[model samples]
Target: MKVLYLGDLVGRSGREAAIKRLPELRERLKADFVVVNGENAAGGFGITPAICDDLFAAGTDVIVTGNHVWDNRDILPHFQRENRLLRPANFPEGAPGRGIGVYDVPGGRRIAVAQVMGRIFMDAMDCPFRAVDKALAAYPLGRTVQFTLVDVHAEATSEKMAMGHHLDGRATMVVGTHTHAPTADHQIFSGGTAYMSDIGMCGDYDSVIGMQKAEPIRRFIHKTPGARFAPADGEATVCGVFVESDDKTGLATRIDPVRVGPRLAETMPEVV
Candidate 1:
């Protein structure tokens, strides 16, 4: 099966680019499933219900989030109503939404998607290792679902890589989020699981990780509060990773990175 996991949708430019190109990309790539990280789909902070719906309509099967999951209080209700949206499972027990969901992919195959937050340099949360272990235990492969995708929303690449290695062979893919900078290392693990340190952001590459640079620069230079952040208004590069996995074992056979649009080189991964 062919699966596409996009990085964080930073803001307006990211959303626009994704919505504009995703349908064609899906058709051209013959993707069976698509997952998008929407933690920053809103005005570079949090995603709203409307934005989530838009992504769903645009061909996203599952929406993953990270620390910015609670930026908009209005989204609190949708968290309960929509099982397709996932927050970090490592969050406290009383968090708003679920962290795992199963969707039926093409050919009647079941795909389980889950998110876990890293503790290093991030908000205090339950240990991601234990959280993932619990999720896997609850949804064992080959029985509860045929394919499993884990999104390790985190800050440190070391932590995300650790999670990928830990879950090697158990999951179909383990991809990272939150850094908003696509890394070059994308490959299938020895265990047949697809792994990448970070899938990056689907936003304008001209700005500071998707936000307008003026505010962040001012804040950093003066050490004082300034204007709130907003998404950069520019042509965005839709960034993500593509994975081809075995239908029966739920293991990846190939993994590749994808970059398209302005501010970045055009590159597409073909399954090997």
Candidate 2:
């Protein structure tokens, strides 16, 4: 099974890049399933239902979100009807949307995808470790599902790495998001799970974490709120991770970083 997991999409540039390139990416990478982080797909805030529709139409099988999931009030009602869009499972019970979903792939196979947020340097939430354990208990890999993906949408790399180690043998891949900068630590754990601290954001990297540089810079220097932050409108580089797992064992056999577009050196996995 081949799964492609994209990082967080920030604003118009990132959203357009992902929507425009997803079809070609699916074809070129031979991805059987695709998951994307759309937490910041709006104007550098939360995503809306319209953006979700656009992504779905473009080939995204599932969309995951983080703390910014609630930035857009318009998405709250849509969650009741959309199972493919997920918020962190660690959110308090009765949260608008679920954090985990199991979907059917071709050939009668199944894949489970879940997102969990870390508490370190983040909003207070339920224990991510416990939340993940509870979610994965129902879907045993190689038995109940052929592939499982966990997105650790977090600010701290340590928390993300811990999640990967904790779910080492249980999931097919454990990739991180929310940091908006790709880490160079793509590797398969001893237990067969592919792990990467972060896959980076799908937006212009020239600014401060995809936002326009001026406001953030001024705030950093003046220590006072000024203009609101906005997404950089420059050309974006679509970033993500590609994982190919063993069909029988439901473990990752190959993992590679994928970065396409300007500003970032191009790297893609061989399509074998």
**Please, what are the lDDT tens digits per residue for candidate 2 over residues 1-272?**
99998899999999999999999999999999999999999999999999999999999999999999999999999999999999999999989989899999998999999999999999999999999999999999999999999999888999999999999999999999999999999999999999999999999999999999999999999999888899999999999999999888999999999999999999999987
- List the pairs of residues colliding in candidate 1: none
lDDT of prediction 2: 0.95
Indicate the worst ten consecutive residues by lDDT in candidate 2: 263-272
Best TM-score among the predictions, by candidate number: 2
How well does each candidate superpose onto the true structure, as a TM-score?
Answer: 0.97, 0.99
The numbered model that scores best in lDDT is 2
For candidate 2, list the clashing residue pairs, or say none.
none
Candidate 1: which stretches are off by over 4 Å? none
lDDT of 1 at 78: 97
Candidate 2: C-alpha RMSD to true structure equals 0.6
lDDT of 1 by residue, 69-126 (tens): 9999999999999999999988989988898888887677898899999888988999
